[model samples]
Target: MSRHLNAGERIIESETLSGGITAEMRKLTIWTTDGFSRNLVLRTYTDSASLQHAEDSLERESTALTTLSGSAVPVPELLAFDSTATHCEYPSILMTHVPGSTVLADEGVDDRVPLLARQLVEIHAVKAEPRPREYQAMTTADTVVVPTRADAEVWAAAIDVLRGPVPTYDGRVLHRDFLPGNVLFDVSQNAAPSITGVVDWAGASWGPTDLDVAHCSTNLALLHGPQWGPRFASAYEEAGGVLSESTRTRQYWRVRDALACSEEVQSWAAPWREAGRVDLTPGVVEDRLDAYISMLMNASGQ
Candidate 1:
């Protein structure tokens, strides 16, 4: 595999990374004949009809990485991608390994929030052509099976507000899954950590800047408590991240995002648990969703 990646080189070490649900990721260390070495990440997706969403995500991620090379956005450089899974076990993408860790350290939220806010602003600032598919939040309407009354009521109210035409935003690049997990930072003993890379671009697409902002806000509220949601928005606005002043505009995105919280909570729980967050559970997620919905309602003056 190392020779395939770089001529005359061999893999010295390989380690699988943790906390990925959609794809399998591994870090490969390869040394050249003269002993020079480099690290790269190999990501592969299994072939499953049920996992089409994950496969599509990898495709978009590959496209985004290739598209954003040499751009200001801090993304991993794409080395190679194979859709046929000929080289590896499954369809794979090889990229330069980024040097940093996620913001899971017991660091002060105050210290980290501003850096997170500003970097997100930079991501939305990047330019991209609009993709044919528009971003859609997972509403209860998307479900085919019968839903409980409680779930029906929750989604019914959301559907009422979201029934109108899908609001549009200036076509900006969106990291659809923007959150603490996807953000990597380089931390030193003496200084503050700075963002090194924004990863997991499988969810990348074209949308309004605020859509990403709202998604991050939901994640902040869910993971940290509702208080952090407003703080994140304030920091973003203070750092000049574009957000609509109109409460209506903001809630349009927020409500759509908040309604999807249940699924996000379920999807993210396994990874969070693997990362040592045993406190995460479906009920906790529900409570967080309730708080977030209240926050959005208040923000929109509804």
Candidate 2:
């Protein structure tokens, strides 16, 4: 691995990262014969199923990193990408590792919420040509289906309320899956936490900025509380990101995300159950989804 990036250097150690649903991450520590050392993240699929099912290919993510170079969005530097599996069991992208920890359910995270809001502002500020068709189907609420009796009636009504033309807005390159789990924070003793980088660009696309906003805000509500969503949205607007106060517009996105993410939340049940998070049950997720939908509707003045 070191030879691919640094000549005369060899990997001294490597560690695999867990908690990733799509791809496996490995931090490779490399040392040169002259004593220089550095760390790089080798991101690749663990199996053919993951490789094929991923939202974006390593090549696509590499292209995105290249395109985002010098942009306000904090992203890892793409060192190299190999589409063919000749060099490894699966295709991969090697990138400079951004030093930080993924903050999930941390007690000290409240102080850092504003910082995360600002980072999203920076991301939305980047200029890019519109890719309207990109991710339209995934973010569109019209296609949602209720899987069982647990979600049938409410899910059907949520879909009904969401029926309309997709709201048009100024297009920006979006971090489609932006959430606390995907953001890395550099935290130290008695120091302000700063976001080092936002990873997991697999779902990235050019689309309405509010999709990103709604996605993060909704996730914040689920992880924190109902109040966090409004707080985060307010913080985002205060940081120079334009978010419409129109309840209908807000509802459009919240509903879109609710429909799209419910499936994801349900899919996570197995993994959470395996990890012993007994609370991540179908009932819990359904309740959360229903609450989130209702929150959006009430906020939308329904």
lDDT of 1 by residue, 47-141 (tens): 47425675566678888887788888889998887766666677788889999988653346678889989988888777665452455565643
- Deviation in Å, model 2, residue 202 alpha carbon: 1.5
Give the winner by lDDT.
Answer: 1
Minimum summed lDDT over a 10-residue window in model 1 is located at 141-150
Report the Cα lDDT for residue 210, model 1.
76
Cα lDDT of all candidates, in order? 0.73, 0.72
> What's the TM-score of each model vs. the native?
0.87, 0.86
Please give the lDDT score at residue 122 for candidate 1.
85
Which portions of model 2 miss their true places by more than 4 Å?
53-55, 84-87, 129-133, 139-153, 266-283
lDDT of 1 at 86: 63
Pick the TM-score winner: 1
